[model samples]
Target: MHRFYLPPDECLKDPPRLSERESHHALNVLRVRPRDRVVVLNGAGDELLCEVLNAERRALTLRIVQKNAIPPLPYQVTLVQAVARGKAMELIVQKATELGAHRIVPILSERTVAQVDAEAVPDKVEKWVASTVEALKQCGSAWLPRVEAPLTAQAFLARGDRFDLTFIASLQNEARHPREHFESFRSERERSPESVCVWVGPEGDFTPAEINAVRAAGALPITLGPLVLRSETAAIYSLSVINYELQSKRGQNGHLK
Candidate 1:
């Protein structure tokens, strides 16, 4: 069945209406007709099995047949990605969402080349979120990842205490391997962390000062492997690894509580 995203407000008791853009896609592009069964996601863990009631150029109305709650991942993973030039950031958002990242925080590292103005942060976040929404629809995921406004390395570190596990990908030899670092945390905690956030630097990586700041804020330095990876690659790779590790653990435990 085809799936679409609708805001929560549009999902009340009354028949829900789709936005003009979605309406056009359903009416003109997909040629959906009345009584067609489809799924609509609210991006807040709710998925509605909806049937088309009306289709017009400016609006598409759906009647909810059933609603199901799609639980989020067992372990929440947030990617602190540095703002890379051009399409790299967009790719990061798309793949990271598919990899089950809970949130994406774009960072401004000392070595970052892309300059995002303060006024543009909202627009940038919206664009990344739109990319995430597209990925969710393609993958049939009900929960949508959030894309946060960009922050500087220092500012990001200042809020580091909120995460149960924090990792900063570094090329420095002194850093521990990511698997080993993650395993160490698993052994120590009674239960796996509910939230983990990994920081990926820009094309040139984080500056010495920025690294020190993050380290002092309790973020551990971890290495991906011997080969160097671009900012977007590192973000997706790290998220993939984290998702695999957590999902494997869940399988071993039989189910999540």
Candidate 2:
């Protein structure tokens, strides 16, 4: 079924309508007409099975026929990623959303090459948010990851936000494979961490000083293997490993709890 995005605040409208951009895609691109059934996501776990009531050039009125609320994953994952150069950041945001990351914080590390001036942070964040929305619709995910404004790594660390399990992709000699950490945690705690976050460095990786600071903040160094991956590849790889190792055994339907 085709899916569209409607903000949470607007999802409960008497007759929910798609925004101009989505309306354009529905009416002009997809040629949706009245009575066509589609799914509309509020990005807050609600999936409305809607029937098109009216389709105009700049508006798509929908009559919701059924609404299903999907429970969020039992665990939350946050990706603290160093802003990659070019369009790589967008790809990271999209994949993070697909991988069930609850939040995405783009950081400017000492070695980061794609530096966003303070004035442009809002625009960059806006674009990343759009990418998440697109990914959500494409993947039919009910939850949308929050894309935060770009901030310096130091400033972000100073916030002192805590996660049950925190990892930093690193090349340090002491770095351990992610499976080891997952096994260690399971052995000690008898279950997966409820909240986890991973820090991925930029093109050249984090500086020595930055790595030391993150380590001091309690982030365990995780090795992605022998080969060095690009920043974009690292982000995807780190999230994939986390998804595989940290999730509890799946239910009979092959869905993670």
Candidate 3:
């Protein structure tokens, strides 16, 4: 089944009209016709199974056949990624979405090569938002992850209080292994934190002062392995580990049921 995302307001008690973008995709791209079944996500974890009632050049009306509330992930994982050069950030967002990241926040550190000015942040964020939408459609995800505006390292560290488990992937030998750090947090997993954010530095890594500041903000320094990965690779790898650990626990306890 083809999946598309629509606004919560577009979901009426009965059937509702599809948006212009969806309408175009359905009629022109997918070539969907009347009576064809389609799925629409409200971007808030609500999934609507609908059948096309009318297909026009500019609009496609759909009749809701079934509605399912897909609960959010038990443990929300946010990626605080340092800005990378070129399309690396785009690749990170796409793979991270498929791996179930709840949010992506771009951080600007002293070592960051690409800079998004105040005026360009909106445009950059818009691209990331679009990438998330396409990723959800490709990966069959029912919920959309948020893409936040770029922030400086100082500003990003200032928001540390929001997460119950915060970690930064570091290359320093002093950094503890990710598994050990994860185990420490897992001991308190029963409390089920509302969110967890992991920070990944740029190609050159965080400056000593920046790393110290993050540590002061309560983020534990964790190592991926002995080898160094690129900024985007490290972000995805960290998120993958988080999702695997949490999902494994859920499966073991039958919480997935």
Best prediction by TM-score: 2
| lDDT, residue 154, candidate 2 | 92
Candidate 1 lDDT over residue span 23-76, tens digit each:
888888888899999889888889999999998789898898999998876678
| Per-residue accuracy of model 2 over 12-75 as CA lDDT, tens digit each | 7888899999999998888899999999999999999999999988889999999999999878
- Runs of candidate 3 with Cα error greater than 4 angstroms are 13-15, 188-194, 251-257
Which is the better candidate, 1 or 3, if ranked by TM-score? 1
* Cα lDDT over the full model 1: 0.83
Candidate lDDT scores, in order, read 0.83, 0.90, 0.82
Clash number for each model = 0, 0, 0
Q: Which is the better candidate, 2 or 3, if ranked by lDDT?
A: 2
lDDT of 3: 0.82
Q: Using Cα atoms with residue i matched to residue i, what is each candidate's TM-score against the true structure?
A: 0.93, 0.96, 0.90
Put the candidates in TM-score order, highest first.
Answer: 2, 1, 3
